[model samples]
Target: MVVACCFGMIEVVCVEAKDIQSAGLGPVTLAIDSGSCTGLTGPSGSGKTRLLRCLADLDCHEGDVSLNGASRESFTPPEWRTQVGLLPAESFWWSERVLDHFPYKQKPELDSLDLSPVVFEQPLRQLSSGQRQRLALLRLLANQPKVLLLDEPTANLDQDNIMRVEALIAAYRNQHRCCVIWVTHDRAQLERVADRSLTMANGRLDGDSS
Candidate 1:
């Protein structure tokens, strides 16, 4: 196994998660393979979100990180970010209507996620939090990212919405051979969707559970 040295840290980038801030993420180490789902679960402030950010290269740290055998430094930040998508915990929508947000001139099958194309026309504010979350998810999936970083992705949804999100993620993983790192407190959700699981504490990853 090859390890990358970023700034002075040695680690694998396939799916490394570590704390990058001064507070630190508590010394977590984890490696996930391609085309599978891995979960990060723990109490709030356990560095789960920070770990996600580090993998996305959104945070600065001494640990090494890479993707598909290439160091995160190998690609320009934009390229890395585009291929390694992060669905933030809180997303913004500025349009008066939802349909206005997506500019899909050539209508494609929204079927992958079981989302209704017409729902995009509703006002952003009019949609519930769960609907907004689903919309954000659709937007990310539309990008066809190679790696997915989701932060509390279903925090605002009902059972139906949660299932939809899981299905969409699963579909993406199966079809594109993409990797997923989900940060959630939902144990049940993790068990249902993740192929492997890990817990975060302080600033580090615990033993990987499959």
Candidate 2:
């Protein structure tokens, strides 16, 4: 079910996009509920990433995207981003050390990624790609965004780490009632993690398939 809030007889949406379009991509629209993970699947170049970019305010596009009953325009870019965070396939690093990139020195969540407290002081170049990917997620989570736009967040992870990442996300979603739009190619992963699934093709969302 698309997660929603009810007040007597009225239902309020979490994330709602209306005719959102970017360049050669969608004129797409959809609403996702709080606490639901919606799997988005499509061929490469189908505009999955671009759509996410629009929602995150990282790309300029027509149509409006709103969250938690407010429009994106209601907040400044940084504030909007903090509320609707996007975790891209490749993370951008601005600091030399792992700890420098984070707001806190000791993130307990690192243990779930098989990382230890000592890792915080290590330079970025010393970490593996998988480690960087996992840490990027933790960095994003620190903001506690009300919405999560994940673009293959665990693509670089091994089987064990993939499971760990999935569990971590699920727990966070349930605990916070956050909405998730997860883009992935793995159909099995969708089944395991998504409460609803949508297929995107030729620059638009086809329909709900899950």
Candidate 3:
């Protein structure tokens, strides 16, 4: 299904996975609509991250995933991943300087996260955990992905920064009409951001009862 919005035509099922199964996770099915946020919460090692990886095609798993009605098999791994971006808890930095990783000039989004322009000049090694987490989110948004798979995106931030990140993601989704699948342990945070919430247990999504 599709819908017309300010961002143009958006697929209701922007992301769909049928029978997705990984080593630790059971066969799972999920459908996420554009401009909506779905919260996924589970105990540690319950395969929440694995499910996100499967959706991003970052790991080998059974079943199929489609984005915008296009099957994952139709595109190259890199091409598919560009449309369905995953922001892991611990972000990896390849270059020494931060600016080298970004192709275009910085935008005001940085300031919204309370990040200074000088942060672009700093080396990756010098950044704190929270800094890396916030910068990682910025990097993901720069890609202009249709779907976002976030795993504990605000784990390292304080309450103030957490709200900042949540607002930034909400604003971005509203503007782009993108789909968001956020995995977090905080129930209150889930309520704040997710249009619908689901709980995972023993590697399977149990219910939206949360």
Ranking by TM-score: 2, 3, 1
Error of 1 at 133 (Å): 0.3
**Over the stretch 1-210, how does candidate 1's per-residue lDDT look in tens digits?**
343433344533355533345356655556666676888888888788887777778877666777777777889998888889999998788777665555463343566545676665666787777767877887777677889999999898877777877887898887887889888888888889887888877766767777
Assess each prediction's global lDDT (C-alpha) against the native: 0.75, 0.87, 0.88
Identify the candidate with maximal lDDT.
3
Using lDDT, rank the candidates from best to worst: 3, 2, 1
Q: Mark the 10 consecutive residues where model 3 has the least summed lDDT.
A: 100-109
Question: What is the overall TM-score of model 3 with all chains considered together?
Answer: 0.92
Over 1-210, each residue of candidate 2 has an lDDT whose tens digit, in order, gives: 232344333335789999998886788989988778899999998889999999999988999888876888889999999999999999879989776676665554677777777667788878889988999999999899999999999899999999999999999998888989999999999999998999989889989787
TM-score for each candidate, following the candidate numbering: 0.82, 0.93, 0.92
The residue pairs in collision within model 2 are 3-33
Q: Give the TM-score of candidate 1.
A: 0.82
Candidate 2: regions farther than 4 A off: 1-11, 104-108
- What lDDT, from 0 to 1, does candidate 1 have? 0.75
Q: Which parts of model 3 have CA positions greater than 4 angstroms off?
A: 1-11, 104-108
